[model samples]
Target: MAKIAGLAVGMSLALGAVATPAGAQTIADLQAQINALLAQLAALQGGSTTTTTACSFTRSLTMGASGADVTCLQQYLQGTGHFTFSGGATGYFGSITKSAVAAWQAANGVSPAVGYFGPVSQARYSAIAGTTGGTTTGGTTTGGITTPGVEGTITVTKNPSPASGVKLYEGDSMKTVLGIKLEAKTSDIKVERIRLDLDETGDTASQDSAFYNKAVQKIYIMDGSTVLASSDLNSSTVVEESNEISITLAGMSFIVPKNTIKVLTVAMDAKSSWDSTYNADSWTVGLATDGVRGVDGAGVNQYGPSAAGVFTNSFTTEDDILDSATLAISLNSSTPNTQQVICELGTDNDECDNLEVAKFDFKAEKDNITVTDFVLDIVRAGDTVATATTAYIYDGSTLVGSASVAGTTLALMTATFSDIDWVVPSNTTRTLSVRFDIDDAALAADTFVASTDADDTTAENSVGNTVTATG
Candidate 1:
C-alpha cells in the first residue's frame, strides 16, 4: 500500500509537465496554443484545479504603436532600470518610448538598437520572463514580432505620382519641387537617402529659355504629404563610386510601407545654381546607404527602370518651329522698298567713289542655334561686264570688324562666308553696314543684285540694284 501511494505521487508530478501536449516548450511559444492545450487538459480531469501561467504580451510594438502591450512594455522597461517614462507609461509607443526600448536593447546586446520588439527581442524576453522588470511585468508577452526597417524585399517603380515628369528651368528660383512618383511593390524598404546623378553636359535649349541653372547644391525630399528628409547636396556630397548628389533626410527614418504609393519630390536649392546639364535632360535618383539621412543604397536594385530609377521627360514642340533671321539693305536710314540697286556713276567715276552706296543689317528672332556658315548672293547686273565694284561691310556690334570682297558676275553670284563666329540670341537684333565704290570703271549701266536677308530659317528673299540706264 505504501509503494502504490509513492508511485501515484510520482505519476502526478510527471504529468505536471504534460499540461502542453504539443511539445515541451512553455507558454512562451504561443499564447493561444498554450491556452487551448491547458484548457483541454483541465477538462480531461473533471475540472481539476490546475493553474497555468498567463501571457504578458502577444503583439509587436513599433514607433507609432499604441496599446495595452506598449503600456506593459513601458512598465517592464521601467522596472528593469531601462526606462523612466516621464509621462508615466501611457501605453503609447512614441519617440520617447522608442528611445527607452533602444536603450534597453543596447543594454542587452541586441544587434541593432532599434526600438522594435522583434522575434529576437521577444525570445530574449522569454528567456528572462518573471524576473525584476522581466517579460511578465505588466501585460501578456508573446512572439511573432517583426523588426522595423526590415519588412521585406521592397521594389520601387517609376510612376511619377500626381502628374508627369518634372519640368525645371535654368536659373529658376529655389524650392522648386519635382513630384517623382514611386510605386513601392511589396514595401518594407527603409529609404533613408536619395542620391541624384546628373550628366555634366545635359541641357537641350528645348523651351527657348536660357539662363540655365543646373548646379543644385541642396534639396529636400518628401514622403507623401509629409516632409520626411532634407540634405545639403553639392560637390562635397558626391559619391565616389558613382559621382552623384546625395540628399539625406534630417533627424528621422523614412520607411516605405507595403503596397503604398510614395512620392519623392525633390525640392532643389534656390540659393545655389543648379547644374545646367539637368535641363531638358535625364538624371538619376538612387536609394539610400546604411547610414542615417539617405535611403539605403541596396534598395536601388529594388526599383524599376533600373539604373536607380532614373527620371526622364521629353519636351514636345507645337506648331512650325521657325527662326526668323533677317538681313536687309537700305540707303541711309530709309527702309528697303526696292529689291535692286546700281551705282549711278555712268560717266562720273568720282561720284561713285564718294557715294554712301548701301547699308546692311542682320538680326535674329530665335535662341541658341549654331550657324555653321552663311552666304550672301550677289550679282553684277546687266549685259555690261564690270568687275571693279568693290564693297566693304562694317559690323555695328564690332564682332565682324570690316570685311572687303571683290565683285561677282551676273550668273547668280554667290559670296560664301566661313568662320562667321556668332550665336543667335532670341528676339535680339544685330546689324551690319555696307559701303561700295565703282573704282574708276566706265560702264554703260550695271546693277548690283543681292539678297536682302538670308538666315537659318525661310527662303532667301532678294533686294538688289537694277539700273536700266545709268544716271
Candidate 2:
C-alpha cells in the first residue's frame, strides 16, 4: 500500500511542474516563441526590422557616404535638376549619380569629372542652397560650385551698406546690385579718373588755336568732355593783367575724363603800341626769349630781332661831284681802287710830260671803280703806266706829292688789295690830274706803250696822252 502511494506522489509532482509557467516549456520551445513575438513586432512596424541588412544603398552620395544616405542624395539631386532618374529615385548612386555631378560641374564653370564634393564647389553649392551668406572679405569670387554637399543657398549683404557689391551662384538666379548688368562671360568693373594738360606758346598759339578749334568742334563740353585755357601773353592787357589771365586760366572748367586741360597761348599779329618796344620780328616769350628784359614782373618782356650788331662801315656812291665838274664813279664793289701818281718833271712839260690822267672824253665814258679796305686800281686803259716812275697827284693847281711806283707795282698783278684806305677829299673835281716823271732820259723819250694789263681791253689805245682827265 505505501509503495503505491509513493508512485502517485511522484506523478503528481511531475504534473505540478508541468502546470508551473516558468518550469513548463523546454529551452528550444522558449526560443521559438520569443522569435515569433519579434516577428509580430516587425510586422506591426511594416517590415522585418532586424536592422534591415544594415540598411544599405547601392552607391555613395559623398566621398565616404554610402547606404541609405546615398539614396537620399539621389532624391535631392533629381529635385535640384542635377539628374533625371530613369528608375525614379532608385536608391542607388550609379551612373546617374556620376552624370549628375558632371553636368553640375559643366554648368558651374568647373572642370574635371572628379565625383567628390570639393570644398570650393561645396561652399558655392551651400550658397546656392541659402545656407550661408556668400561674403568675401577680399572682394572677389575665388571659387565656384560644382558638386553637391552640405552648403546650401546663401544670402549676401554689402557690409558697408549703400556701396554696391555683387553675388552669384551656380544653378541659381544671380542678384546684381547697383543696377549693373553683367556680361555672360565678363564681370562688371569700375574705373576711376583720367586727366590731360595742353599748353601752347605764342609762336605756336595760332597752330594750337586751330587744333583747339578742331578739337572742340562737334564735341560738346559735357561732364566727360575736355577743358581749355588760354595761356597767351596777348590775353593780358598790362603787366598786372597777366595774373588775372592766369587766375582765369586756373578757374577754367571742363568735363571729367572726356575733357582735356588745354592751354592755348594764342599769338596776335605784331602791333605797335607802348608794347612795340617789346615786340620783335621773331618775338617769343618765356624762357626761350633770351636776352629779353621784362617790362613788368609778370614775364612781359621786350623781344625783337636782335640788332644787326657790330657792323663795319660800308659806304658807296654812284656819282660824286667836285667843283664845276662831276665824277661818276662806281664805288659799289667791296674792293675799290684809287688813282695815285707822282710828278718829277720841269714845270714847262708839266701839262703833257709830267702829267698822269684818266680821261673820260664823253659822259658815257664815266669811270666805274671799286674800293674796299685795300689798294686801288685805275679803271681806264692807257691811263695807268707800269714803268718804274714817280707820279704827282694834283687837284686843279694843287700839287699833292711825288709818289714812287716801283717796277713791282701791281699793273695787272693778281694780288688783291687787302689793306688800303682811300677817301675822295671834299674839294675833289671831275678831272683828276696826275703827272708821271720818267727820270731816265732814254725811257722818257720812249713813246708811251698801251698797257694790255687793263681789264677792259676795248680801251687799250683809247687815250694817248699821259695827263688824261675825266669830266
Best-fitting candidate, scored by TM-score? 1
Off by over 4 Å in 1: 1-153, 161-178, 182-191, 201-214, 223-226, 242-258, 270-471
- TM-score for each predicted model, relative to the true structure: 0.32, 0.17
Backbone Cα, N, C clashes tallied per candidate: 39, 40
lDDT of 2 by residue, 57-169 (tens): 33325544545656655555554455565575565556446545544544443443333445554544444433111212112321222112211211111122112212111
> lDDT of each model, Cα atoms only?
0.43, 0.29
What is the Å distance of residue 467 in model 2 from its true position? 30
Report the Cα lDDT for candidate 1.
0.43
Worst 10 residues of 1 by lDDT: 462-471
